[model samples]
Target: MDDVSSDKHPDRGGTRRILLAGPRSFCAGVERAIEIVERALQAHGAPVYVRKQIVHNISVVEDLAARGAVFVEELDEVPDGATVVFSAHGVSPAVREEAARRGLDVLDGTCPLVSKVHAKARRFADRGDTVVFVGHAGHEEVEGTLGEAPESMVLVETAEDVRRLTPEDAERVSYLTQTTLAVDETTEVLGALRERFPLLHEPPSEDICYATTNRQLALDAVVAESDLVLVVGSANSSNSVRLVELSQRQGTPAKLIDRAAEIRTEWLEGVRTVGLTAGASAPPALVDEVVAALGELGPVEVEERRITDETMHFELPSALRGTAGSRTSGGQS
Candidate 1:
């Protein structure tokens, strides 16, 4: 990690400052998922087959790949009876059954929060409730959650979609959401649903995860004082992409990059104060790299503006607990 202290530094046009967002990098769920893969690799040895990218970050996948984590697009590619781990995004019941059928030693790295969504969906379906789920259509999280109650759940991506939905039993309808959706947009869709069905049921708690909500809130503060925002993450990460969109919507120029190399010099032509943040699945090391690159442009100053302190952590799955990685930090794991 970059050890540069948060101090003011001057540039040509104005003070060249970077407003770093706290709670910007890996969340507890992401940490737990990555640790699962690391522990599985240590316990079982190299060439461990992973069903998908352990998390959405390319660098994270690359790091594990170097350590012999074999990522495949599907279970079929994995040899029969080989040990396989699932991604942070939960998989469907069908996936679990298929793994069992193949005789693979399965170690699920799915975030516990995602697993909660699956359980809620299944419960709603069991009670004959038509579940209206809000999220991107093809997201892995959505795919897995939908699989829990395919026949009972209806997916809506926009407020207009909510208007068009016709649940089989209008009176017996409930709603769930993907954990990484933009809070404001989800609210608009939920509002539309409420108007149509006065008694619409909501999840026992907010469906959107706390980390996503906190990061967006932090971005709100960053954009307020930043001329340009650099969100460090990959394209496929829903929460990462949402951070870029949220900044753009707030009228601040923002770009999503997987690493420091993608930050174009043109974007920084006249920028003074830049906002630095990362997706939930991203590592702080990526943010450090970007900060180092920015320093090469000219003298750079960093100020960490925190929205909240995060003490939340998810324990490793029971099957893997009390093992070698019992107390490993996210970075070391």
Candidate 2:
């Protein structure tokens, strides 16, 4: 069975230790995304086919499915004239065209920041500038961004990847990034691009999401003293996977899990100090439950590392827009 959200369970007895990672879990984009889908479900009724997981969380996706939301990979998979909502991860113009071609009642849930990257890509392409997208290959967000200008901008997953791309006009090169990438990794990739292109224009604003940057920073602080780091996120979540990578990159042992059941005894072996964090699409309540489960394991102290605060937000599409509260920012449910 797929691991869905963890509900209330009787307190299990372990060491009774839980170390909460500050700035963990959902960012404004994801929080607002869940609200959008739930609101659409409440407002429009069943048979709402989402083009992809609204976010990367498996439990969240399953929860939405249980609530009558259907997940599909492409617009073609959706029946004609069905109500379909796009995921927070942006899609390409081609997808939109196909959705329109299929005559689906589309509600775009793409994050505003991601839309910004798309807009930048279009503008760069229009100006005859070679655009370079810095992000991991095969990620949904990267795929969407690549759709913007497949023939123009090259996808560079690393700084090393950037060096190999030989644009016809180095002086007229520009770049955009995937919103959920690690801040440090993006910086190195951008550095490499600059070194090679010498003069590449970047998007007016950074593409990495504000919540992703903040959560990673908090991990850097809290993971320093912990013997083991547990990142509470689904395997598919890009930001969650990066948190695990972030810890491991720092030479710390980290584990990524959908919930507590995946937690192993050996992960805590010789681990007196354990650090806990989650991905952007993850829910804080799940993190809380994980902490509680760990508390049963042994005596544990919880600490909140105060990192930079988040105030970023995105608006739903004009069609979905209303005089609603700004749910797109670091707004939580």
Candidate 2 residue spans exceeding 4 A from truth: 1-18, 318-333
lDDT winner: 1
User: Least accurate stretch of 10 residues (summed lDDT) in model 2?
Assistant: 1-10
lDDT of 1 by residue, 15-90 (tens): 4788998879899899888898889888989989998788998988998898889999899999998999999998
Clashing pairs in 1: none
Tell me how far the alpha carbon of residue 94 in candidate 1 is from the true structure, in angstroms, after superposition: 0.4
Candidate 1 worst ten-residue window by lDDT: 1-10
For each candidate, what TM-score against the reference? 0.94, 0.89
Evaluate residue 204 in candidate 1 and report its C-alpha lDDT on the 0 to 100 scale: 89
Model 1 residue 237 lDDT score: 98
| Backbone clash pairs in model 2 (N, Cα, C under 3 Å; residues 3+ apart or in different chains), count | 13
Predicted candidate 2 versus true structure: per-residue lDDT over 1-333, tens digit per residue? 111122311133333234556688887788778778777776678978999899999878888898799999888789999889889998988999998888988888888788888988989998999999888888888889889988897888877788788889889999888888888888898898888877878778778877888888889987766667899888889999999999988877899999877888877765666788889888777777777777777776676676866676666656556634423212231
The deviation in Å at residue 332 for candidate 2 is: 8.3
